[model samples]
Target: MTRHMPISETQDAPPRRRITLPLAPPLEQRRLQLYIALLLLDGAAILNGFCIASWLYLGRFLDETSLLHSQVMLPIYWSIALSLQVYTLTALRRPNFARARAGLSLIGAETVLLFVGFATKSTDNFSRVSSLLGLGLSLVLLMWVRALVRPLIKARCGDAVTNTLLIDDGGTPLRIPHAYHIDAREHHLAPDLSDPHMMDRLGLYMMNMDRVMVSCPHDRRAAWALVFKSANVSGEIVDPEVNMLGVLGARRERGYGALIVASGPLGLRARAVKRLLDLALAGGAVLALGPVLLLVAVLIKLEDGGPVLFIQKRTGRGNRFFPIFKFRSMRVERLDSTGSRSASKDDDRITRIGRFIRSTSIDELPQLFNVLRGEMSIVGPRPHAIGSLAGEKLFWEVDHRYWLRHSLKPGLTGLAQVRGLRGATDTETDLANRLQADLEYLDGWTIWRDLKIIVNTARVLVHDRAF
Candidate 1:
């Protein structure tokens, strides 16, 4: 033990420092696992519920022998269906088109499963008709449940990280002056730093930074260039046109943030596509639902005497005034007394037939013509009454970004309508939530998303969810 060891270069070197990187918090890791596990378990449970309900309903019509066979095979069918649902949930985390594709793929996979089961000469175990019914019901219920839960779960998980930096030379901070939380977090860097290189560095740094706020005047061409450069490098820029100066100097310098510069509007292609879809789908819908339209028109006229259509001035794209169309659902006398007003459930203004039509959303059928006329889209931010601008005045007055809603044609039914945001806006919170949903739809629009909204609209209408 006393023998002196010769110093070798490797052995004599200072003990190698062990760099222990910080692991994610154990609680956080456990939370993530628990959330994922819950989702999977929910999917499995929902699938099982559908299968059991289907079996119970179909069992009543079958012989005891068939019932016994179904009881054995039902669990197998549910297991397969649950697996497909899990696959769909994983795929929806990407893009809207991907989500739609995932939904269709799930349907296809279920169909294949059915065929496989049939080909195996296991037909006696489950009635072919009942199996097909179960499959259809399961797909609709599961897909809808996924859609409803996905956004909620994502919100709960804090998926959105919107910290924008507005860079502007304008003396005022770009903001909705009266609104609280107008700018989440604002900072002014240095007003005198006009050098393009300085802006570029700042922009790049802001992009690299997590959440930053920057504001510059609309006329500050240098700021635009810097923002554009930052957008190119970081690819996380959210340009919300605001009017605030000095606020641009305080822009944040790090992660997951957007640099909002005063630039001319972007996303012209999306606007154009929205218009084209509005026109085409509206025309097609008008043509397809022509007979139903005629019937509704006749019923409205017969119910209220005379005018079968009600027209009112509403805000359209870019805050422009447009006359909106609807089947006359209110008595002319009541309307005249109350002036233009939002119809409430059991509103004294609504005629008996009007109530029925409004409940069924047939009253909105005439707006299809508005889509064809290029004043509206089949799906978009629902137009609001020009006169009903109560709490929205701050948004209308100080926030130019609110005008962004008008960049596309208003819709017959939109992200708001299908998500229980259709009712009367009695409070500021309601308006904010509705507008947020609208903005989300505008930020992320795809043909598939439109189709999903359209499908959801049809479902709501059929079920009399709208009033």
Candidate 2:
């Protein structure tokens, strides 16, 4: 029995047995506890598996001469297990227990073990037979532990999951255990396929949910697919004909149905790593470019004596507004607040230094501050000013798909920018083309993708179209 903490002992039991109250913690806290417990359990299993394997092959625990050797090996095993990302595979995102994940993770563990065996000359300490058996046993225990725990987690967090559609006009019993059945006729949060605000709310709701069963127009399938998978939510639907996957590059994430899908990609620790990288890179850029930025600031002040930074509101994730920073490369007095006019080549409103910065894409440098502020990613869809236009029409008026770009934080530079789609939307075709690139970035996002964009962006920095 897995005993959840935030519990207290009761004095009614005899001898050694004591009763504990079901003092359930907050949802997020409980989820964190579950993750920590899983890591600890896997770590312990690795140690135990090694002990058993050692005895089987060498007739002693770790075949070590001293307990000190075992203690040193204990931390090493834990370190190796963590570095292999063994816990990550357990952060499932599909509808089933992915026993395959354990096998894949074991392969990774085995490879890492082989590297360590050679590096540390572990073959000289323990026989090859012991090493292989120990690894096999550890992974076996990992899979076995997950097989037992996944069901319990599903049952416990079941309201956050829906195996069957609970949407109804009225009076339908939700068949799935702990499913949050909605009387669609009266439920304010019921998904409205046509309303963008409603879709946003539903997407927000999905951040707390795992598998969600929804019914909407067939044409709107792509929108829901972007919303659900971007949020990492998955589910089963009775209507087999309603599939919107691969349209905008959304793929069905199998093996996560039984597990909770927290918002975004790459699990908790992976996200932390990405976040750390963002801060490091952004912070480093600010420091590395300090002299260039100061020079630009002086030049801007010398020309107009206005704000060095052109702080403007741009749409961020979930259509939330955040201030994006740029070096003011335009005459402050002539800046277009409505986004009605797009900058063109050799615009008179841009001063000499402005022309240089704007052309060199140096004006976008201050967005590193936005990245450091957590208002933007180092790479993603570039944040467009509100009321940004495509020809004579506002971007949102161009298509509903335009709004889907807000699914992630806007970036300093993006797939569209690096791919020569930067500066001026002169036609609906241009706007549509950029939207496609943005969708591509969102659906196929990775740290590597970000790095590639960053590298590619340098080549186009002085392009003619930028101004």
Candidate 3:
């Protein structure tokens, strides 16, 4: 006969192990479906933009001599349209009302594209009025389609739960429903007692299970102690109250583990897809913008007799060092001696051309190489300088959890930048808020999320939110 050992030598006999917890299903499949849906919708928006642009510019097609008739103009218009669409999508991912934000972002994107086209002399082949009308119509149609599709998409992909274990004061087993249909099994284990041996066993069990939850009553000192020890044993312990804010949605309930189950990690496949996307987008952007980059480099040199490209050491994943590149935006004299100064809107150190590129984020184009070099991602938390503090406070003075943002690779643009958290960090509160957004993005990394940040970064840039 098989024998099970008691948790402690002091115990008279081994406690009865009456029940085996059910395994919760994995959520990877469900997350992937949502990602695929978002991609399809985004692709549709791009196609819609192109078709509308083409229809409006068809008058130029009738005249072979028109500039819009040139094959190059077609691709240029398409690229602009796609960029605009991406910008709008990114803005929509944040806190704004979805429909209104999408409309505003689309309009803003189109307006910028029009100006860029005109500046590049590409509009000579297409009628300006026709392009404007096409842009307006496309924006309206795309907004309507998004409104119609968002709920359906959310229904299909949102509210997915992975298997997690919740330990409650009563030590009863509970099952949390899966967010989406998945085949992987999950398990939940809660102990009825607070013995150190039991807690240790639970901790070991959690490490083996991949995910676990522990709940305690209002008088949770003992439970907290157990969890603290468990946390040391394994890094997977989650506070039921703090982390379940969104999931429970203000619902009150008794018993800690009532709503918890253990399932393996979800969204691994989605993460892989996002990495692949970063590689492709970064590679393509570097290739496509080579000429424009050269022109900008020349302009930077002409504007000031300094190095065309500015390189600085920035902190990235794990607080490692990497050289970040940007077109020189400040007079060489005022480059921060401490490398920790933040730029203000009216900072006098900015050069003439520097203000323009900084406002337009053209100054940041050189960092695309950083993305190619794998030192950064196309989207993530914006990196800060090593030894930088939140305002006058030292780095160690702030919450220790603040450094958790460095857990992921830094990005050229990120959730904080898109949300108007870029530019100067005037106070600790500013840095804290930015760090909060960064951590949120890290916790919820996904392909759609990255795309959303990219799109929003463009919109925010055109609007001059940083300045």
Candidate 4:
């Protein structure tokens, strides 16, 4: 809700400079501690709610058979809890009004329970009164859990105040009661715009801040926002003339000041929905493709008697490394894990079956496992190997902004791939164009777009670049 914004934007800046901000340890630790405490209490509440509901559900017959059912339902219930984000929703930093909305969240839990019960065929087995009673108890216990944890959260974090950075141009300062405001217009905080040393110090100072408010002119807000978001901080333009109705989020509230998420492709709820869909679809695909997978394995093994699966480390979400699996296409000796060079159309290292599999994209079937493991997505930007290059330079070296593509998980097929940007990016322009499409995908990410990309990828399987 309360995001950071850059305070200053040197309008007539001579050159762009990079700023490195170190994270604040004390604040980060306190935040993590509160989150852990909230999670533990939520677990406790769910357990207590389950016990109370079991008593009413089973009535006079509390036997071991019912216990088995309960065991079966435990994970489902846990997942229901997670999907509703019960723990996170009840965070004490949120106002009491927000905390009270836990009841509304239960609606989501109830909806999940209905589908899960039907999927597991427990709807017939479980009593109606029991289910209703249990859900009611959960609602109560969730509130009680927050009530118990609220003091602990407040005691450690101290009234939910933010370390705010205010960049006003010697005008009226923000009068936010809970914010520890640091006005950047002062020389001590934000020094000469051209000084590299000052920039480094400013970066470090901003890390200690929770929010950055730039008191700039209305039209310049967009430019200031980019600068702040580039630094991976929440950016707000403190413009009195700018109307929030149009620019701010539809769900934006009348808080102390206007704040919106910066650099996010989608809202929190949308991301959750996307993640759930990925898990469900990826799981189903793995199950349905079992026979095809086995046949591919056999074909790969019979070709050269080497490893049937190719396991290579590739860049993943947040630039993290994860092993990607594919039906081994090339011979063991010729595998290019680093992606140092592009695979030529008639590369000799590729086996006969490998060529067929790669052409048909059967080689990429193993990546459903990565999707299942949550390291990759059903659709997004395609991750390259760490040593992947656009001609002479590494992909990242071609454009420093390329790292932004890693914000979301790498996909089995991506926006770029569907748009015909797959295969080797042989030039800087090639890589830049792919990055542009990838960034656009990130900016306007939606579940439907993922589905379309997947469909498009399927259509392009027999293309010339598949080799």
Candidate 5:
């Protein structure tokens, strides 16, 4: 969590002036509100169209039969409209598309109403001439309302449908129309992964943006790609060869091109479900294991009169640092908080009680609190300590994809742990095996898969490599 100098600034240089650029509000965030507004406006248009038709053709503004027809037609039209994408972002952006969809929905609704009326043997519900006039007027009104709102929508949401941020990170120069651009040198913005505060600074610039495109040098592309993945944002790198590689996707606009690198794995609903599962399981485990936790705390405290819990900073979601809790399995004097030293069998650092807890994997039970705090999940890639290494190389040095695993919250137990990939990573091959499992877990996540992983974790609690 160390704070460093701004991305481009040095200690000897004078403070850089912060510049604020014009930014459009994120349209994606306000889409729900716009949809509701469009729905209400369409409803009003339908009701007024029917009333005018009733007055001109039926000699009454709001006859009971006409009112009933409008009521019956509204819900049917709405359902049809939703199915036709009449109330979506595309509808808002294209007036012609919106009008055509609205018209189609109206026809579908009228056809459904007539069929239902005939089925019920009540075909005389209203005059055919009046109904025909009402349909024609409603169609006109729908098209008028849709056309009228196009200019207003443009004024509000800008020319681009999604909010975009362009970062000029000492790479090729490019411009995205209607996108907010910031000079990395002027803003003092750098993607320093080791510094949580710097990541936070970069995150602020990306706030409310649907996509972030970085124009950085070739050397920095990997670093920026990792940053984007860890942040779980839709990210793109400016490169013409991107389309040739057939990566995620490519965006070519005007004379500039970019390659999409990262996108969020879970949607809003999926995230909500996952979070609820974590809260329910973590909360229940705390209460059910209350006695065991208490006994362990007492034993750890009495063993050497040391702290009951061992807290060490581990890399969590978004490549941020979070303190993970364990039941103080190592002696106070011998504890390796930085995790530079890996535990091994017959290690003298473990106390008598620590030996029992570490062997049984009871030392890890305290991490339920991390799950409750939303820092960890019941099943995911295990968080690695900042200084953890495989053989002589650091974990990230062994595999750059290590950062991608942090895109999701670290877990109490992971696919690696259940597959017997736990304990000391003695070599690069050991770390690579675990990293492969972690990456595989990310490909097609499902609630059922997570449940299966949790079930599998129970059988390996007392693993051979745990100590």
Candidate 6:
């Protein structure tokens, strides 16, 4: 018979293991439903306010004019509110923020209605006293309903609006309010990419989590980064050094901190605005530059009977590669597709028309098509060829942050190009200077700034740096 080893005498006794913690239920599905409910409630409050006001003023539940006003105001308010992020996860967690956005949206909508009414000479149709009462009551109801939903949001999302899981793997200590903390050792967890079962365990812990953050020793960060990349979640690694590296912002909460590495720099509204701008300008530029483009294509073809356009692989948004279009400037036989050779003063490979077009920035006109195709932008960091070099090293080798510039679509003319930071990068300093400007452009992007950049670009179309 098998005799169990005595606890005191045995050297191989198994230690007691802690029970695995239960995984937190997914909050995203419930949170979406809550958002829909809040939206309906807001609409109801607006309609009820207008209905009640009409009854108080005209002894009717729904005055024809008042109902019409509510209908118009409702769409306007929703449009403005969406742009202001009134219906976001942040708004759900912070009721005051939601209330403020709602109030501002209402005020803006009312102002718009007033302006339109005056412009259209329809003020007489809308009762001034009734409108005023509706506005006041709408504000009251919006605030009340938002406040009422706070507890419900809390119940659904927990204290943290996001499902945040903090995995401590023998790294820096951190604590965040309502975030699930798991000790890697206790759960027998490791970023073991080779072991399928270990990965399965990791996936279970991160299941339904909106954000998975890991604080691990420097040696393991790479493995964790790879793990998180395929995890289909917003993953962040806790690294305080990102502050020194000029991170966009920081969140300090309950002694827990993280640096946002990979995120969309532009929000939904901003992206929509930027895309609209891109389409308008790119479309217009293509039409306006049609003659110039046709002339250049004929010249390039006539010069050597070769391809009119040169397509080179360049790094684009998310560090992905895309073919960039340019008017073929070099001889077909001597073409450097890899862009390994920087065009210097009096480069022998440049054709006669190529030199003129490059200096005049006319060759870049073809990229208007790239902008229209949504592969590039009118204003952003310029994309570089994969083999492009600074000094003797590649651009990314010069600075690790070099890849960060590709976070947005490469632009025809960027802050760097407009600032006269163009041409071949002969040294590391050239890239550094341009990189600094690109980073500056990435922050606080706006339509006004983009328009300004376009205007400024025209002034630098014939810079000395252009080869």
The candidate scoring highest on lDDT is 5
lDDT over C-alpha atoms for residue 25 of model 4:
27
Q: Could you report the Cα RMSD, in angstroms, for every candidate shown?
A: 22.2, 10.6, 18.3, 11.1, 5.6, 11.2
Q: Native-vs-model 6 lDDT?
A: 0.81
Lowest lDDT 10-mer window, candidate 5?
1-10
Better of 1 and 6 by TM-score: 6
lDDT of 5 by residue, 324-346 (tens): 99999888989998898889998
Going through the candidates in order, what is the number of backbone clashes in each? 33, 6, 19, 5, 0, 0
**TM-scores for the candidates:** 0.43, 0.61, 0.44, 0.55, 0.73, 0.60
lDDT of 2 by residue, 247-295 (tens): 2222233222121222454455555666787899999999999999999
* Cα-lDDT of candidate 5: 0.84
Question: Candidate 5, which segments miss by more than 4 Å at Cα?
Answer: 1-163, 186-208, 218-223, 240-248, 302-305
How large an RMSD does model 4 have? 11.1
lDDT of 3 by residue, 1-467 (tens): 12233232225645543332222333445545654554456445545554565556664323333333223333443454445443332333331344454555555655565687779987576655655655565566666666666565446433332334434433223444531111111222333232323333343443222234443444543443334322322122224453356455222344331232212112355546756877899889989999989988888789878888788876565434578888888899888644666777898988888888888888988988898787788887787665466778644356545545654678888888888887666688888888788768866456777788888777788554544
Q: How accurate is candidate 3 locally (lDDT)?
A: 0.56
Task: In model 1, state the lDDT of residue 215.
Answer: 39
Give me the displacement of residue 182 in model 1, in angstroms: 29
Off by over 4 Å in 1: 1-268, 336-340, 389-402, 462-465
lDDT tens string, model 4, 51-166? Answer: 57777667533534334444554556456555555445234467464345556655565676678778988678666676567667766887777777667666766665335566
lDDT of each structure?
0.54, 0.64, 0.56, 0.66, 0.84, 0.81
Note the residue pairs that clash in candidate 2: 93-256, 94-255, 94-256, 94-257, 95-256, 95-257
lDDT of 6 by residue, 1-467 (tens): 11121122225647644334336777766876887798888888888888889999999978999989988999888889889989898898787899999999999999999999999999899888998999899899999999898888888888777888899999888876778887787667898754434554566677677778889999998777656644445678887666555566644333455655344467546877898999999999889888989999999999999999999987676444678999999899999988877888789999999999999999888898899888899998998877788899877667656655765788999999989999989999999999999889878888899999999999999989899
Off-target runs (Cα >4 Å) in candidate 3 are 1-271, 463-467
